[model samples]
Target: MPPLNYFVVESPDPVGKDAYERIAADVLQDLDLIKVIDRLHIYVDPKIPLFVAAGLLRHMPRAIRVSDFANVNPGEKEIVLDISEEAYLAPLLRILWARFGKENVDQPDRFTVVLPAGVIGQKEIEQLVVADPSETLYKDVIYALQYIAPEGFKVRRQYIREGKFYYVASEDTLPGDIVERVVAPLFEKMGVTL
Candidate 1:
């Protein structure tokens, strides 16, 4: 088996740790974000009606271009692409349609796309950005955290730094010092369990 990632859930009940870990891992994997997270710390106090999740994310994903996942060739009247990876396919299609107009971009198969000549040059196609994963990742993380956090603790505050992210939620209004009081302590303890 592969080494386990740094994941912790601090609650009065340690019995639920395994369940939380499984859920967290599944979600992160589906989002293609499991490896980017260096550590995750979760704390919930039912009595206090609070939930906190603080994690350290590695450098975000860089902008992905069509050339990074597909082979492109400019023909006399069209540009053809043979894609080997489908991870960014959806975004690539959207970008192509937007730049070349829907009528000019054609997908004859799952692994191929054709573009009319003059729609975009070979060099331009090579550098055309399909997606910026980090931008959507931020929103994905926030959405995932909402599910991880306890239900009914709807009021929330979130913080995102260069390589870090923290979330706090509670039933009642949180004070300004919430991060200093809660997330800061958990972040301090990350990368090593106490």
Candidate 2:
């Protein structure tokens, strides 16, 4: 696994800290988040019934479009999408099917899609979004953190923006000053002003 810029786990209990560190690392790896997360700090205090995670994310990939993986060609009576990459073929087909209807869209082969000419333009098809990495990113990050956090720490608070994220979970209601007192300090240690 590639190394994160910084990874820290803080807890008063040495044994628990070590155990949590391993658990956190395993979870991050399993969710394929290590590459995206640049810096991470986790604080767990079972006694205080708190689990806090703060991190910075690297630049996420832009949305994948038809033109990214396919070449649009105009045929006599139909528009031909000469797919260069098969990975996004399924999504591309689904979007085409939805927009043009199943009957109007034809996938004669794994590498091609045909649509009736005049129904949609080549420029429009090229811009159709096949995938957006950021759409599922926050969900994946939150899911990974939930698994790393102590089980039953149900009361939760989370914030993710631009390239920073923080998750707080506890059985008890979170304190009002938690961000200023806990999360902010963690980010500070990571050399992030927030």
Residue-pair clashes per prediction, in order, are 0, 0
List the RMSD of every prediction in angstroms.
3.4, 1.5
| TM-score, predicted candidate 2 vs. hidden true structure | 0.93
* lDDT accuracy of residue 146 in candidate 2: 92
- Candidate 2: stretches off by over 4 Å: none
User: What are the per-residue Cα lDDT tens digits for candidate 1 across 1-194?
Assistant: 11335677787756666666677777777766776777788888777878889987867889999889999988898889999999989988887777778988899999999988777778888998888888988888888888777678889998776878988999999988888888788977874322
What value of lDDT does candidate 2 attain over all alpha carbons?
A: 0.90
- Quick one: best lDDT, which candidate? 2
What is the number of residue pairs that collide in model 2?
Answer: 0
What lDDT tens digits, residue by residue, belong to model 2 across residues 19-45? 999998899889899988999999999
Q: Which residue runs of candidate 1 sit more than 4 Å off their true CA positions?
A: 1-5, 13-32, 191-194
Residue 132, candidate 2: how far off, in angstroms?
A: 1.4
Each prediction's TM-score versus the true structure = 0.81, 0.93
